[model samples]
Target: MNLDELAKKQSGSIPGYELVDYYEAAFPVYRVIVIVAILTEQNLPVVQEYILKMLDCGLNNIGDIGGFLGLSNEIIEDSLVPLTQQELVLSYLEGNSLKFSITEKGKDVMESLKVKKPTITSLPIVFDALTGSLEPHKTGLAKAKEVKDLEIPIIKPYLNKPMLEDIEFNDVRKLIKRMQKENTDIAPPPGELLDIIEVEKAWLEYKRLKVFVFYSAKEDDVMVQVFERTQRAPEYETRLLRMEREGIRVLRTVKKQSVRNGLLVENLSFNNEDLKSNEESIQEAEERVKILTKNLAEAEEEKTDQTSIHTIKRQLEEARRQLEIFQKGDRVLSTYEHRPILEQALKNAQNRVLIISPWIERGGMDDDLLALIRAALTRKVEIHIGYGISDERSSNDTYPVKKLKEYLSKSFGKYLKLHKLGNTHEKVLVCDEKFAVVTSFNWLSFKGDPNRGFRRETGLYTQNPVTIKNIIEDTLKRFNEASC
Candidate 1:
């Protein structure tokens, strides 16, 4: 039962090792694999190696643990300190060399998790008053592969039950495939994956409406809500809006139903406005489906005799490559609509962040932006800021810019560089020379204000290394020329 005995037993499992950790009880097997690989597989002494592994497992960074883990990164990160203190994990610096290694005690902690058993408990059953039905609410399951980065429900602390039935596996696989095809970034809820098969008919009635339901699992409550189509009140607006469009009236939930396994069901009713949209969407879908079905049938008949398996395989491979490229390079951002695109790019910047904005001032710098910069700095990301001085602008209007520069110099010291240019007006952001955003939007001044009739800004975001390299070279050249 102790850590030592558990580690010994787990070590016997060898390449097929199992991980057990009380603290990491809620984590899925894949995540545990990440930890196990770091502790046992990665021989590199540098903490950077372990960090890279986390990134490979879909974590943006050590700070972005919550983005993947569905838990606080700070908690996991802080736990490492105590791990070292207890001699469960060793940390040392040899002449500016940083290294991390799991001690024998650490292996014991992992071993214990492998042997741990889950506690069985009864799930809360929903009580439907209107139907007077006492049917047990069935939980939905997603294939583990589909929700690889999603936080899956743990049957009990440190215990996870595997999917058993072949029918269920095939069903979940199809659902996951559909989800991946439709939305790559969206994951299913903890307990149940939404069965779109049953909803497709109803969904087609409003297929034209851009609607999405994102769900999350709290301690004892499963929160499910639809994405906002209309821009809410001023106070409700986020720092970034993914879609810049006017709102339309939607189907509203009328009566709340009881919860089962933390899943809350509700009765929804559509108003006249919603019904009108639904009718339009249904007609469009019918016409579109008819055309698509006809085209598909013709294509299939033509290909049936002519198409070779090898040729089909090659076509699929090519299609996958194109999809990957499109997904990476297709992110076009408008500062007039979405500024968070740039903000997120900055937050995810690991090695460097290069900004070329003609004007930079403290007035436009919000707390969120400041925090992002500071976080990047903490990760040792180089910050290069290029700005211009305008002849039309007053010399006395330099306080905000001056304060910003002073703060950067004082805070980040050697990692920060501020370049003053002569009337430069280009705005671009390049991160690690791997991702770049070139925009007409002022990175320093513009925050999407609906009331402000500012110039509608447009920007292109690309992950193409060649494109990023060209932009970086050109921007650096301009910065150098402006200095002269």
Candidate 2:
């Protein structure tokens, strides 16, 4: 039988033969041969020459099937190793030379091969527009071949067609619509061309999967270097082997995801071009929308409250009455009443712990308070201390500040910020901008001082963001001014 008749009969009835799965299994080797054979009927004797010729068939020719598959030569060869082991292709010594040719099985498989057309119809000539490789076209061909026999009205004419470089965008859209309408197994799903960000994200995902750090040294995009190594296990062959497997898996996943998303090279290129052309307009529109949104929000905020003055006065008086009553749950703490509450707030600090204690005696920076600061700092909580330490004072006020600085500098110095204030008596501590304390009781010296000698100290604690924000902001400003 002729090649066409043989393909038609055996392609249907060949036992255990699935064009899609087989083609996928045999890939680039299947692709490389088909592309080369179709481009030039003359069977090239040399494998390298054959590969190079196949490369020349397309715009990109970065040596071997790597250019076509958008992968490295090592990875492509690794994939071919399985096919070699399967005995699908024949390789034997021919007159002191290692020669390779397609076996009968390979021929049958090649005959069954079909290339899908992924031509993009662009009005403006877009040469060298697509990046990476022409893998989609090759895979599209295989998928198209597998479904060539389907009687779908929309895709019938495009069956068995060679992959095209470009076609009308609208024509592609129409074909996709028809494919959706027919609901045939053979019709490839609509594809989206990945953009710059998406392509980078895919590469990042690939590197992440491979556990390798990918650093592109090419600043202006003239040259490129791809790193496939982990710092943890540098200069090891085993790591490279793992990386190869990971690279293959990641590539396969990326390809599958891209195809599933209906991402087409031609369409993607067209989309990028469209984006580039309209980027300025898009940015301008976004800015306009932002302005309009801000205006709308301000307008809403500016709308006058309809409540009368008499009603507002009554609400204010009721709020004052509630404050006077001191609700049971009000967390306002005092050194006399809830000294432990202060320590608990310090321990619970998650994000930021700001302490504005003007006078810090050596006794005030107690073991418990210092331990809490250390623990909070270990949890990445930022600690800012605004202290009043007079140089003139003997080993009392200045001594504690000096000791605290030394202790913090040893371990948590980087996280702990010391802002020395001149003489301000503000004693407040804000934790994570949520819980706060404004107290007359000195944070460092309060607990240690004897009740008989100590002044009648009192403090107010609040868990209000507004109250905390105002206190922190005002105290921080004062602290900054004093530090200056």
Candidate 3:
């Protein structure tokens, strides 16, 4: 069906809607109601409003279509554009504005997504493989007036299939209650069955249109996006050696898995290394969980009932711990978000700018991020970029200080005093003491479409003094202190 006819027939999610999109096709395989709950019902109207008013894409310029639909101008460069890189959409420059329209595949996705106007009963919880994660669901059911203990149901995307009857929703509800109350503790399920039950329970509530299924592996994606163009060689042993300390492989891998597969290019050959590092991270996160659990246990022993403070603190601790793991490093990390909502995060930082990228160049970066950097420079943000040049082992075509020096001079201008430090391999950007964006992105990955610059790369952004000091001081230590 044509776009206009589909619109007419669908009538734009009219009242009393219970519609769903059962994607029998590829990309965004979601049940209709679930789609509405996850990506659309809540934010679609906002997007519609923006398109109707702000954007003016016509017969002339239609640069990146998915971006136009998926993001506002502010986050288009960081989030939406990265999606385009992953072939999720298409985006390019047009005059002063970024005029975008969806690709045929994206359009097919739009058609495939089941949309409906769900009741204001529940919100979505998407378990991203990459960016962010989920906290166990707490409906305030026990906190609320219990109504016959409506067995906490587990929902699934396979909407019509008969659910297996063995798992009891009652036990699951009790488990959620313990998790929520910390009678037990926060954890991944012990086995595949528990995991399935977890999914099932999540799905049941989800079916009531409670959540979404935008499966995101942003962690791995974030790693892949940032590390692709990183210069890895046999010599200048620091960059290569640090991987062992961090339990990551030094070399990058670049290959496509199969014949039908469109070139799967993985440059960071440190797969085993990364896996070990990631496992260590997970274990550390769990350790923190144990600490919090201990605290909760002590609190429970002291009191007859758990208070709101404990609950909030428990949630906050877990979320914060996860954020730390998330902060480890990734390709497309942002200082803050500015999409579907407007934020002036970068506004007040016109005084002193500090940027440190390990490799410093690659992505389809001739776009918005560069625009911001230039704007900062024009406003005399006093840019001080510190890059760590890895000791060259191979003498290959790797761009060392000379290449980086040339790129900085060529792209950022002669006045751009980009400082080159030795011995560090972290990606960070601290903007004018006002904002700090700590990431895993080197200079090349930041601008590389091959890095998924626009999609959903995860990083930590903060104005909080605690977060700021931790990132900046640690990075500075890596810079000033000498280590081989």
Best by lDDT: 1
Which is the leading candidate under TM-score? 1
Per-residue lDDT tens digits of candidate 1, residues 1-484? 3222332233223232211111001111211000000011222233423433443354433346445555476755665564566555566665765455665655655444321112222222212111111212223323344332222112111222221221133444344445445553432322333222211110000001111111122232111112222221221112112112223112111111111111000111214464355445544554455555565566676775545544555555555554444445425442222345557767888888888666554323445566677777777888777776476642224444554556566656567766776665566788886777666555764422223322334455656676677767776666566642
Question: Would you give me the overall lDDT of model 2?
Answer: 0.40
lDDT, candidate 3, at 379: 62
lDDT of 2 by residue, 399-468 (tens): 4555566766566667788787765455677777666666665565432212122133445555556666
Which scores higher on lDDT, 1 or 2?
A: 1
**How would the candidate models be sorted by TM-score, starting from the highest?**
1, 2, 3
Which of 1 and 3 is the better model by lDDT?
1
* Residue range 147-262, candidate 3, lDDT tens digits: 11222222112222223342244443344444545543332222111222222322222211121111123332211111111232122223223442465432222121111111
TM-score of every candidate relative to the true structure: 0.33, 0.30, 0.27
Against the reference, the lDDT scores of all candidates come to: 0.42, 0.40, 0.36
Model 1: clashing residue pairs?
20-113, 20-114, 140-192, 230-247
| lDDT head-to-head 2 vs 3, winner | 2
**Candidate 1 displacement at residue 54 in angstroms:** 90
